[model samples]
Target: MKFSLYVVAVPLALLGTVVPASASFAAGPAGADGGAGGTAPPVLRLTDGPADKAAVAVTRPSPDGSVATVPVGDARLTARGPSGGLVLAPARSPAGNGPGDLAQVHAGDVVAGPTTQDTPHGVLVKVAAVHANGDGSIAVDTVPATLADALGDAEVDATVPLTPGDLKAKPLTSGGKVTAGAGPQGRGVRLNVDVPVPDGVEPTEGHASALSASLDLSPEFLFSYERAHWYGVQPSRARIGMAADYQYGVKVHAKSSASYATGHKPLRIPAAEVNVDKTVWLGPVPIVLSLKVDYFYDVSADGTIAVDAEEHTDGRLEIGARYDAGEGWSALSGPEPVSTATPALITGSATAKGGVGSHAQVGLYGSVGVAADAEPYLKATATAQNTPQGASASWGLYAGLKVNGSFFARLDIFGTRVLDKDWELPPLRYEHKLAGSDV
Candidate 1:
């Protein structure tokens, strides 16, 4: 199997254009013109055998065997007749130059399908030169709908024939030899053994052969032939091993940057990601669920020592079930996000997320609950910590449209409102692409 990853940094300015079901109709056509303001119609030219002519008023082909011609513009053509009627040819298109060029012309360009639903009568698409193989039949690449309509129905089928018979068959032979001593149930004893001729019986030189034993000899040699090196201590302790991984990435938005204007440099809070997954599955089901913790450091723009905060994360906890739907699949879920803070000095919020899925894909996920740390700690310090701070909860919805090459993107928008107030926040935006991968 092969894997690919890429990062697509779409400018926020252009997000509205491709955001799902969110674009406005007022953008209009990339480019369109008013009816009379549009460019004039293209010129039309026609020709017939042994004579070429130009005319504006032209007669288009009709379903019935009848003919009609009229003037369209200043030019005119001396009307000539074929065995059937004057077969006005199709127009040429830009992709190529030939009779077909016009035969498929639609909107001043060569097309393979009908460009318009309607056409006037007496219009005939011009055909290439007619060639007859001395025998009188002409070579043709395509047939007109009128001719095909007249021919009616034609039947086609594969020439190969099918043979019928019963598909089931018996095996060449019934069950053969079964190993008697194998696996955990058998103590690994060999059911068959090879024997070597006694040392003195090798005098005949005509034919010599050898047979080999299947089991290793080093450990068993002393226990069977020597028997003198036996001891009592068989290691009694079994070593156990464990492993884990955890992944976390979060974005924090600032309420406003205008408050802290002059002294400090603009703060850059790049997304924080922490991944920890722990597993201790020595044999079977009911493996111990692992817990992972993450932390983020956030600071207020104002140079206030009181607001430089740290997010002590309560890592996700996940437990996998034994049964599953397919290979590389598992039914598992994670614990919610929890934070550590003291009520006396800090006020913070936390969230929990968990779902069951396999690999890097999430089949189902949802929020379990929200919690805060240091609520009592904040109440005690409220008199001294006067930062005029507020907090509220908000969520966003997202839907992915299509995959483009290696980039997978989705459109999502969020709204925030101050609790118990009319203040509404502009929708928050987010987009992410797979950034990298390892072998």
Candidate 2:
């Protein structure tokens, strides 16, 4: 007698909305100068040199809107026309000191002492008033002191309001050094400073922290086996039989968003897919099978202290068998159970002071010639500790899969078993991790 079987299994369709990538916010621009005369207003420069070399000389703005002071030690102040330049010399006497102090100038101001060539015609330094705007912008009223006749005949006084569109920012260096400089442009001044937020994050008055997170789908796991069995010791009575295969893995569609001092936005990840298919011949019976798994996940971080995650899974399997001859083939089994909904195997959250994780396992069994098991897991953790004199915060997320299974077949003649065997496949595993830190 000759027989054949064919099977086809379809898994459930994946679900859930994917969050869009974060939007990038440009740094505010330097405010326009409100002075007349078409003369380019004098700008402040870190006479010390490039930001990397003069980092220590430049101070950063605080959350309280305090001024970031920059020393004017021998810094040169060049204006547009001839005799429109002056050197920022230190005050020689207490009476010669500007409103603020000696050599030191606030973030948005330019200060200088009496000129070396002419004490009476030396430049006077006027401090600037810095304000933090509600819409993530900084405004500065750069009151350039009345220029001495030796430098310029005009009084360069103006209230320049710098907006987020007015300032330009550069990437932070390894040492957290920010580039700082200011220059005059068409009766206006341009100020460049370092604000340590990621490209996509916007920093408002109260919020100024950076955050990033992600989720990924790993490769699938599959196993297959084949063996032959003989019927009788006769030449024409000889027969070959027994072949099997097994496979299982999930495709993950996930989205993540974060809320911190900086800001919040949704980030999306492409879906990952894992599919398995195999064919086996049991004597004159031929069997074909396939399986698929799909799932969705969402992760969010609230402030700098806590994180949460949630997930759902829709799994499916299909098996079909048929008999094939030289002329045609006959169907032995049709696709019935189209899909299966599997509960989330693992879920959990973590905090800045500790870490948490979860794990879950599932099994699949079939009579034709296939059986297997799968384990999926997720873990989240955050660490905060003192390092000698400083403290640091670190967070991470980990996920992966592990699978193992077997394939077998048996035959009997006249109530006597003639052939029986099984093949065991080794376990397979895959894992991924994402991490970030702040000090």
Candidate 3:
């Protein structure tokens, strides 16, 4: 069946909401100038360049109202101006590929062109004004819809006025609508139009669509792993804040949240501390560093963190640094002590007591591992070094609790460990008490 289609720009009303409509490229007699018969072919002229000033004398005109030959020069033109600028958009190529010579120019876009340029090939008019829709999008109106509808056949020609009698129609055969399962390509089945083709006519237009379903997922486990391993995920922070340390480790942001740090023991409870260490390679070898922070319910959770807008929650602020050795000490030595394998980080560190500290016994840290019973958690063991004579080294135990939090943990307290010994070793500080160098 010859189902002809036409392409026309739909006027968008700035006084109301707008809905995007799809249009087909108007088709017509085989090999016609406009694809649509009895219409002048579209002309291409640079609206912003010297070529726009070139005039065409219509050297030759074809029977189809197409220019067989035309003049091409910058001097053979007249300089005319439109009231406002033009919005020029990149035109898609004929093959639907990419940018082409053709441009989509809206009436009121302030196009980049000097007012002194003009062409005598076609008629041009001055646009009264231009306006914005407030958004980054532009809205241009060439002719009022009311006036154009009233002018009818005079405003535009190819679109013939359809009389009431043109509404008569009869079913040629029958078409079927899909009432059941999805089609082969994961979409709803399509309905087939069974109308027969006319004797010398060909179908010039058609549309096919099928329903589709899509699923998006965010797995907790995967996000957890990615956050733990990837440092410097956001480079902008490093470029702005820590340009020097930026080379050592990319700046990383760490946040933990909960509806409420509640119950006898909520895993991420108020000021409950957790230590997670990973081994990364800046070059060929590995640099093992640990992130230990005791969080306080700090900033109110931003709505971006969750799907439900009304479910406002709270989050913890992290006060920690990406690590490099204090001053001495080998780069890595892994998560555990290389010489002792004691599962402790005996490294020089900088404490916020405001300066650098040497040989700080930070604490015992852990990696993500499941217990023998498949209980997923990080295993921890707190240890102390009592280097003074006759003192005893004490140790404690803790696990990086994920769901079940530290019940009694405070700002400085970690997990559920009770401070039994005075292991208050000063980030475990000591200045090598250098045997006899005047204490």
Candidate 4:
């Protein structure tokens, strides 16, 4: 396994010309013109190839010919070119390239199936090159010329055989990867979606019910357009898209600063930077309030603002501050912006009772701003649970009252100050199709 982290930032001023070059750079053309754009190459990978004793074998070798096979450990793969794409040439093909360079491993030395299998007239050989996925996974590029001719009507029982796929050359796209050859553009309608607001702005009642109050600064939506013929056959070209989605804990965008609609120039931002600073109050109470800011633009476009906040936990990490990391989160009590977290992602609430003075909780904080001492006594508690993919967590007894208010508004003053005390609940329903699909 290889770990790589990098920050890439390109000003929109010169992005117009660099955008198209990014695609061409993968074609492996020699020269400064083919030098990659803002994208970074993958790190070199070294995996233990299979043993020679378990090496090549011809599934059905051609009756007459026999190709040589090298010992697994003897003939290993090594980086040879600046590009990360995989090659089938010898190790020192380029002689002396540094790390993250082009790599090569021969088919004959394959620890996989036999390098040359028996065929009717000649042997079926594993030659030529291939590309790998972002994670160094094999992607068959072309089938060997001899092997293709020997197979005739038969096929190689592989996920991606060179026989059926286009045998044309492909430009290496990444380390161990390439841009598969395909035809030109086909005529079809294209739908592009990009909401300027980092967090989508929901329409208010009539004009607006909940106005998103903030100096919105994130291009937080997706922009993809697929052009398929509405009448005849669908186009075979790959859909062109740019995903400036959220990362770490910040929302990334895709807007040319000068213009929201037209000047939507291209900008490539690699890794986001995080800055965190905290202030601890250790007087009669021991509590720490931290401030964190995510720098999207060069400077601090926003800061964490803490208000009268008090939190208590048995064992956890909690802070009160307004963070402007694109996910518009307001401070606990301080208000810099309204809630901008997306809708379907999360919905949580908690209620505890049994004579402990009942406590109901609701929060969409963290990304919000800071925590203030609240003039006097202050207490805090922090809790965090990282749920892995496909995991499920359920809470709530399906009974209780949920309300929020400041210290000034007494809870007793307002009834359950509960409405209808009825156990009946209305139908909970919502319908939203993936926006990418056309109406």
TM-score, model 2 to reference:
0.22
For 16-54, candidate 1 gives per-residue lDDT tens digits of 122111111112233343233432111111111111112
Model 3, 203-309: lDDT tens per residue? 22231211111111000000000000012111101100000000000000112122211112211322122222322211011112222322111112111111100
Q: How close is candidate 1 to the true structure, as a TM-score?
A: 0.14
- Give a tens-digit lDDT track for model 4, residues 118-164: 21111123434556546433333334332211111110110111111
The segments of candidate 2 whose C-alpha lies over 4 angstroms from its true place after superposition are 1-305, 308-368, 375-377, 406-424
User: Which has the higher TM-score value, candidate number 1 or candidate number 2?
Assistant: 2
Arrange candidates, best lDDT first: 2, 4, 3, 1
Model 1: how far residue 56 lies from native, Å: 74
Error of 4 at 254 (Å): 16
- Evaluated against the true structure, the overall lDDT of model 4 is 0.18
Which candidate leads the pack in TM-score?
2
| Stretches of candidate 1 exceeding 4 Å from the true structure | 1-256, 259-306, 318-331, 343-439
- The candidates, ranked best first by TM-score, are 2, 4, 1, 3
**Per-residue lDDT of candidate 2, residues 252-297 (tens digit):** 2221233322222111111111122222211111112223322222
In model 2, the worst 10-residue window by lDDT is 1-10
Which candidate's lDDT is highest?
2
Tell me the whole-model lDDT of each prediction, alpha carbons only.
0.17, 0.24, 0.17, 0.18
TM-score of 3: 0.12
